[model samples]
Target: MALSPEDVIKKSFSATHLRRGYDETQVDDFLDEVVVELRRLVSENDGLRTDLEDCRASRGVASGQGAAAPAAQGERHEDAEDTQELEALRRQLAECQEARAAAERRAEEAQERVGAAERERDEARSSLEAASAGAAVGASAAGGDGEDPSSIISLAQRLHDQHVAEGESTRARLIEEGDTYRTTVVAEADERSAELQRTGQETHDRLVAEGQATHDELVQTGQSRHDELVQTGQSRHDELVSTGEQTRDRLVAEGQASHDQMISEAEQQRSTVLEDLHGQESALSATIGGLQSQERDLRERLRAFLSDQMERLDGSRPTS
Candidate 1:
């Protein structure tokens, strides 16, 4: 016969002829402890497996049961919140994208501005150079008049120096303005990018927290349902066993009564008793047959459940 964990714990083994076998008491204790732990693990494994199956089965039951309606409503509310959050996030992303586009446009505009500024500066320098040339021509003409030639030359030199200083000052101011505008544009772009990053991180964190909470709720609900199913199954099993025991006991008692009647009754009554005993035997057989059929059905269901479990486990197993 196949051994259950309990049987294994209770079993005794024949000693080896060579006196080379391990110590029996120690071995028995170890094996029994192992069996107990194994049974516990098996029970826990079965519970977890049942919980998963029940959870899968209950997916369709989200809104049906009375209490389930509230749960479903809560779930729907959560879903609504999630949808709203997602929509909000989408809007934020669109805004961020728009900001990025705006920044890009500004950068392009900044380049254009810089280019225009450079052109303006170049034009200013060119105008200054042209003016300087004109001034030089005027100074040369004045110096060439031959009246106090040295004084005329000195005055012309001073006027030329003033023109040169004015041109340099104007160029410096133009360059400074372009630098300031470029710096401002760059700083705005950096700030927009940073804002987008911060918003993205916040959205990620909110989604993660929501997902974790949902997971915990599902696990807790599944565990509660699993425990309920297990208890119901156990109660039904116990009831069936008790019914079978009662039927067996009644049959045995009737058989004893018939035996006594056969021993004490006359021939005619004995025949009647014999017929009653035959009827009782047939009933006992029927009861046994019924029990056997039920047992077979139970066994078949168990085998199917085990096959499904094995297949599920195999599919989930990781490959090296």
Candidate 2:
């Protein structure tokens, strides 16, 4: 029976598995290559079929013309050429069919090989399992050879105890390391806090001193200017008392406007400083949260490692 393209591809994949010992990836690659070749063959076959059809149509046209003109030399020559071309196409088609058949046969053989290999692999696995079970039974029988089972059990218990003790030691060591890390973190946190506090205190003291100096300078300037103005105005006070009152009113108005401007500027500066401080605090909080998360992850990893070690130790422990 002729195999379909899909069957051929499947057989090819199976063969690859048989030859290469059940490599899925290799089988897939082989199938892909087979598909590419199959597609090429299909295209060629279609082209050949089309060529054959054209040849047959030409032969039919020649035969009709030959029937119309029984002795026409030109018609006879044309008939001969058409016959030759048709023969050539038939031959080519036959070759393509033979090639396809051979490919299918090879694919089938590969599939059989793969099936055989799989069966052998399964048999080997079964043999191994049986052997292992037999060994366990033999070991059990040997244990029942008039020997004191309790003595054997006791020795096993001692070995298991020793293993457990070793694990405990390891766990104790890890705990110590964890404790050391915790202590280090605490110390760093304390140091950072102290540094921040000291820096804040120094900044506050410097700002206070600067403010006091500025205030003193302002007060002295105001007092000196007031005295000068009074001394200068005393002589002219009698002549220009109303003028002096008008000027004083203007100065008071200007000072009030300046004071209001200064107050608004100070309020804006304070708001900006508060926003900056808030941003810094938020950043620090995020940093602390990240550190805490990292610490938690580290602890989890350490625990997982310890658990894995414990499991290994338990598996290796002697059974009572």
Candidate 3:
């Protein structure tokens, strides 16, 4: 099916998970290229169609004059040449259409892969969150289960440590995955960009060469038309090159920004998690310290009371 620019612009991908998948920005940039290529194809096809119609009309005119003119042989040869040129244009148009369709298919496949990765990441996050929540609730409930404060505190501390460890591991894994994926993507983009530039240069050279040859051959017959074709081909080549360069730069900038943003967010989240863990640890330490202080005071009071009771008993024994 044919894809439109709006479909690309409106497509959304989940952002919270940075698993091993196509970068969202890269995919969007690729879709943007596809859209540009599609537009170019359409425009070129329209021009070719118009040129074809003109050629047919010109041929009709030449045929009308053929009946009254003595240059029938020359006109017939010209008509055959026009037919060949028209066929070539038609073939080029067909190829452009086919390329457009292929590009659309690729874009769709990329979107699908990205969507699947996002769904998988979502599921993993949900499971981890649920597990952490359940563990927290269990730890809170254990304090009311007739367990001593020390045991409860120990259990809570272990759970906290476990959670912290898991968080660190997950964070590390995600960062590594992101780095690997980003590296791979950037490399591929660079390589692809270079290849495209080379291909564009080659195509431009070939087209210019062909235009020069045609201009030489038809200089006497249609010099103005030949010049126009050359100018148009040169302009088209320049536009394609400029567009490719602009796209490459934009994709590079976006990829860097995305990488930086991901790193910054991960750091912020890590900091927040560490801060909460530290606060919890500090609170538990204070509670334990307070309990110990109370126990020491009770011991001192019991010792003093026993000593006073012993002295009173001695006095009441009549100095024995």
TM-score of each: 0.37, 0.26, 0.28
Model 3 misplaced stretches (Cα beyond 4 Å): 1-147, 221-320
RMSD of each: 27.9, 57.9, 47.7
**Which residue runs of candidate 1 sit more than 4 Å off their true CA positions?**
1-54, 57-64, 100-104, 123-207, 223-320
Residue pairs clashing in model 1 are none
Residues 192-215, candidate 3: write the lDDT tens digits. 556555655665576567556644
lDDT, candidate 2, 58-177, per-residue tens: 323223335535534554575566556556555654555565455456545555554565565556555555655555556567776766555555555565555545555554565555
Query: What C-alpha lDDT, on a 0 to 100 scale, does residue 56 get in candidate 2?
Result: 37
lDDT of 1 at 202: 82
Rank candidates, TM-score, best first.
1, 3, 2
Best by lDDT: 1
Candidate 1 to truth, TM: 0.37
By TM-score, the best candidate is 1
- Model 3 lDDT-worst window of ten: 56-65
Off by over 4 Å in 2: 1-144, 223-320
What C-alpha lDDT, on a 0 to 100 scale, does residue 236 get in candidate 2?
44
Q: How does model 2 score by TM-score?
A: 0.26
Question: With candidate 1 superimposed using the best TM-score fit, by how many Å does residue 252's alpha carbon deviate from the native?
Answer: 34
